[model samples]
Target: MKVLPSIQSPRDLRLIKKEHLPTLCEELRRTIIETASKNGGHLGSSLGAVEIITALHYVFNTPEDKIVFDTGHQAYAHKLLTGRQKAFGTIRTKNGLSGFPKRCESEYDTFGVGHASTAISAALGMAIARDQKKEKSKVIAVVGDGCLTGGMAYEALQNAGLLRSDLLVILNDNQMFISKRVGALGKALTKLLTTKYVQLAEEKATNFLKRFDELGNNAAKLAKRARSILFPGTLFEEMGFRYFGPVNGNDINEMIEVLENLKDVKGPVMLHVVTKKGKGYKPAEEKPTKFHGIGIFDVDTGDTIGKSNSVTFTQAFSDALLKLAEKDKSITAITAAMPEGTGLDAFRDKFPARYFDVGIAEEHAATFAAGLAAGGSKPVVALYSTFAQRCYDQIVHDICLQNLPVVFALDRAGLVGEDGPTHHGVFDLSFLRDIPNLILAAPADENEMQHMLKTAFDANAPFVLRYPRGAGFGVKMDDAPQNLEIGKGVWLKKGKDINILAIGNRVHPALKAAQALAEKGVDCGVANMRFARPLDTGLIDEALTLSPRLVTTEDNMLAGGFGSAVAEYLTDKQADFKLLRLGIGDEFVEHGKVSQLYDQLGMSAGQMTDHILKWKTK
Candidate 1:
């Protein structure tokens, strides 16, 4: 009765009869939905991938046979089957089962993955290693059509083809990435699947096989070869992969049979398995994009719970960008498959011609935006801070080197709760600081954000606006956007005993810390140091003249970040001031609530207050 509870590992799944797998698949899907409703994670993709994962475990000898997951969004079912069932409820929590497959987390997780388009390479590497060591275990890489669109995936494919490695690449054609699948590749898949050729071939094969006796197997092979000629995966075949069916991935038995047939079919086999994004759940099936990486929801009705009431920084950026776009006809909006996440969907709808959703290719988006800017267009590339890392080369070579006036609106620029170390945008400030002709601005609240957005747009350089995730400080917003002076810091509160210079979300907390310090008879001043790159040198000089002790805090890494910039500037100036830098530390932060992480990592107001008080007494 309890198929999931009885299962402890992949072996237990292998022990189960083929007739009982449908029930197991149902249980797995429900478990994912229920767990995600409580813990909140990548729900839709995982739900869709249940049957694939189930069949893989049933067919392959995992732990010995390596199975690599690309991006790890669809591996929740894999995690559930691979001895993580008991700890599954605590996933993406402070200290729990990881949302993505991590090698350190389990033996079944052959390679740790968070980002996309790396699975084929990793699996190929493992396959090469297996061959070198003369091992017998099979190596498989599960990649989505989304991952295939990235340049890296193709590069790996080309390399794997040359090596002619005994690797199996499963192309999970779900027809959806985080956003709807884009580009020519997705279009090709759509075209190949929807054609009458596949239907006619299947009908003819089935009827002919029915007429015959146990020669159906022979007829089935003939049908497959005929279908291959009619509706083929030519792209994969050209890449040196022996291409297989566009199989019904939802049918567990069918997948098991197909995988069984291909188990020993050597030298780079490509199996295209078509699956629904949200197969079982009705609500998720209808609105799969919204359910992709969702917050906690009521399991019964599929309504999301625990949404922040106040206006978020993303909303502020969207509103500001919308207003900016209305006046500036030259302005163009671009996102790397994250129009909804980056709050650019509204803009995309409002200005369809100007907005470009460039699929999950961040590098292309960056270079493309640069091209647009070079062509006399004001291109605004709105990407998450974490994903912005992918386009570093493009940002430097194409955008910054050319000195293009492209606005990089980096939303989720600070600690993103639950998603863990892989998703946090804390390193952007450090990485972008040294890039020449780059204007880096971090706003303190919703009001300052609007002004900063305008300021970036009005500037003639590679402007970067970094803002945190979740709700804003609910400050009074101005109707008309005002462009502020570049490379300047504004005083939030003035005092004489100590100087607290903070950026972005840390500014509000630093102000509270200053207040708390004031209660202890420690007169502390707070300044919203809006820009990270420009340093606000005059403000630092002025603050030092007022107070002997200077403290710099930011919602980023300490190494080469906002505080590091301040530290380097002060060192160069030969300023004789006791300085303290507060931010994320040397280690990768674990998953938790943002506030909890702040407290743990010593970035919270209370923590800041304590650190400052200690410094003052010393």
Candidate 2:
């Protein structure tokens, strides 16, 4: 009899014997590992969080008692327990189970989360709402220690302290956050675990309380005060939270006991629980970061199944930066805790002094790079396109305002598959194009990306290079990188019937569409409009001379995007060309394979050809 398939909900889980809970936890881990191995996801974090999620569901009267998860990647167990077990295999697939917690999906998920350090703030709000409504519901926030590196977590903690509401914040310290922990906060947390005296005191206190039946009821309070006397949870204590535990979060029994004891405690409480990143799976435990967010893998060997031999845009950027930095000693790199993901780990290893991992602080990374550029060092801040949204103000005020020479290398700047709307880089063109003193360029392939990187440094202003995720077109590479002429567009093929102007990753697709159209007797031309900021007016003029109809394509949003820039230019000039824009529409794109999404959006070569033919007939 399998404990997992039988257990449909937390209500069913509550009926099971306390001793049998560990068996259920094991079953949950097996299910999570098996499902994640088949359909790629946030494996290590979800695996480590199995016991914690199981304990929370078992101890709390959920559906009423709210449990908010920071960086919802760790909520796989929660989803399974909340009657989503049947559809768990379809995670991250289009129209299937979402990778993260979604409010529309289930009643058990009190808050929808994808980003980090937001749980505490969201939980505090819920707790306040419950109090005002006179509802007897407990609100708990399960936050990873990696999320603590972000300033928003501190801001929420301070606000929660001021509110003095009945809220519980469980700090899930796995000693890792995507990569190894950085900064003084991680050091402080590690120091808390190493206090020999505190460990002994905790043991003696537990033993002493267990012996006294009447005193055992006050065990949590007494232990908290006793621990406070020694090293203490001074950080949380000062923030007006009753600090409890450096509890073993991986142990199901220990977690349940601690959570049960602290359920009714008054005011704000912080329970520090330590767990391993990849608790059960051996491969993930050894290299948690690689498994943090991964693709399909072999379960037996713990190896990725379908890795491409061609270099990705991220790799191209990394290789280009490494070559550029060898001669330019003033060149430095910065990342907001995504060194490995952005391919800056090599740069970090080679130029340790020039590399800075600013943890999960995107705003800080942008401003810090601006400061570096202001002081004579040329800094390149590499970040995921979605994460870069957090530093819009910094880009505008700190870097662009001063006209500093900071290169913003934004990776995954398009329809990023599997991660869904929360991780898509589709809005970069719309948001970044309006900023003054910033040169925005998108590459058509890996070869162009290197030249754009070289161009960015030479421009000596706030420069942005946005590229899509995954492998680029395996075009022949230049022996050495060369700076491209800023705001210049190159015509790949000329046409008489219609001309297609495309930017970034969409250029090759547009060219393919043009080729297909030419076979159908429609003379179509294609041009790679490299810069989104400075529209290539000369290219547009040349296209207009060839044909009155022009089609603009991009991997960004249709509104206020590359096509919008072309439309704005044509409108200003009173041009007589009929314009058609092709890109993502005004909707959040769901998670799916990149090919499936492009085809569905009518951006694939065949689809684009069909769309253009239909429009031309119209």
Candidate 3:
């Protein structure tokens, strides 16, 4: 009856009878659902992968036999079985278990992964290591169909095909990649090749051919050959991997059989397994995206608890973009595998033909947008701040160099909470602001985000509008999206005393600091400085008039950020002012609540005000 307690590692699992694995899988699914509901994690993907992970670990000798998971979101089941059951309660917490596969966490985790389409390459290296050592161990990589769209996966596949190394690639085709998969490959395979009806027909034909002894060998072989040509497996075969499946991924018995058959399979092998996301849970199965990475939901009702009263920056951009799209037919949106997470699901739905979901290929998405822009269609590619880093070269060479009008809306542009350094969006400011032909703007509020988006779209050069994660201050939106005087900073408060110029989300906190200082009989001037690239130089000259007193605040690193830009401007103008730079210092922020991180960095409203009061007194 005690299933989870018995298994310490893969070695312990091998001792168990094969028939008992179904129960173990059931327990694993229950454990995943229960833990995810409490701690909040990749629910649907992890739940869907319970049987597959269980079967793989049971069949293969892990720690000896290497297994790599692509994207790492679906590795919860793998993690749970690999002596990490105790740490399941603290998933994604500070000093707790990481959400993704981390090499430091366990010996079983052979490679660290957060980004998509990397499993094949990592597994290939492990396989190579095994071959060089003359060891008899398996190398398996479990990747989603969604990650297949990434160019890296194919690149690795091409190499694997050429090398003919013993590698097993399990394609977990759940018919969705965060949002439903886009592009012709996903459509063709799901619709025509791997359809349930088509697979059933193929199975029936194969079984029927086996009855004839004399003719069966040739006839069955011919039918099998024809099926391969007609299906998506041939595509993988052409790439140099022997292909199997369209197998039922949820069925423990079926998965065991397929994996067992492929244990001794030579060279590269791809087993395409069909699965339903959120297999056991009804609510998750119905609306998997909403529950993808949830936060403490009611398991019985399947409804998320404690809805935030505040609206996140992502929601504001989504709303603003939808309105802009309504009026301008030329405007279209694109995301690299993130539709729901980036808040572009509504836009994607409204303009199905116009919208593009270019899987986990940010580089391709950037270039594709350039091609779209060159063709005269206004393309707005909204990607996460961290993910945006992957396409920096493309932005510089393909879009900015060509002077294409492509607007990149970067979400979570600063220290994103909980997911830690890997998911943090801090580097975009340093990276994008330095680019030569690109125009980069960081918005202060919801209304400002809308206005900046319009400005970026209209700008002839490649542009980026970066905003931090979480809710805005519910600022009233009276002004519609308009073309602003480029490189402008609006003064929020007029004072003859200390000048504080802040960019993006830092502007609001600086305003609060100014108010607190005003209460303490200290007059502090405030400016909501919008553009990071073409900064308001004239305003900087005026702010320096408040002599021997000024400060620059930003939600980016103090080095090579807004503060550094301000210092550069003053130096260039030969202006004299004792300027204090306030921003994240040179250190990687840890996992915690957003507010806590701000407090730690001394960037909070109270901390800023207190510091200013002391500075004025001295």
Tens-place lDDT digits, model 2, residues 482-595: 989999999999999999999999999998999999999999999999999887899999899999999999998999999999999999999998999999999999999889
lDDT of 1 by residue, 33-105 (tens): 9999998899889988899999999999998999999999999999889999999999999888888998889
lDDT of 3 by residue, 23-128 (tens): 8888888888888777777889888898899889988889888899998888888888899888888887766888888888899998888788899999998898
lDDT of 3 at 121: 97
Which candidate would rank higher by lDDT, 2 or 3?
2
lDDT of 3 at 517: 88
TM-score, structure 3 vs. true: 0.88
Higher-TM-score candidate among 1 and 2? 2
Instruction: Name every residue pair that clashes in candidate 3.
Output: none
Worst 10 residues of 2 by lDDT: 176-185
| C-alpha lDDT (0 to 100) for residue 597 of candidate 2 | 96
- Looking at model 2, residue 322 earns an lDDT score of 94
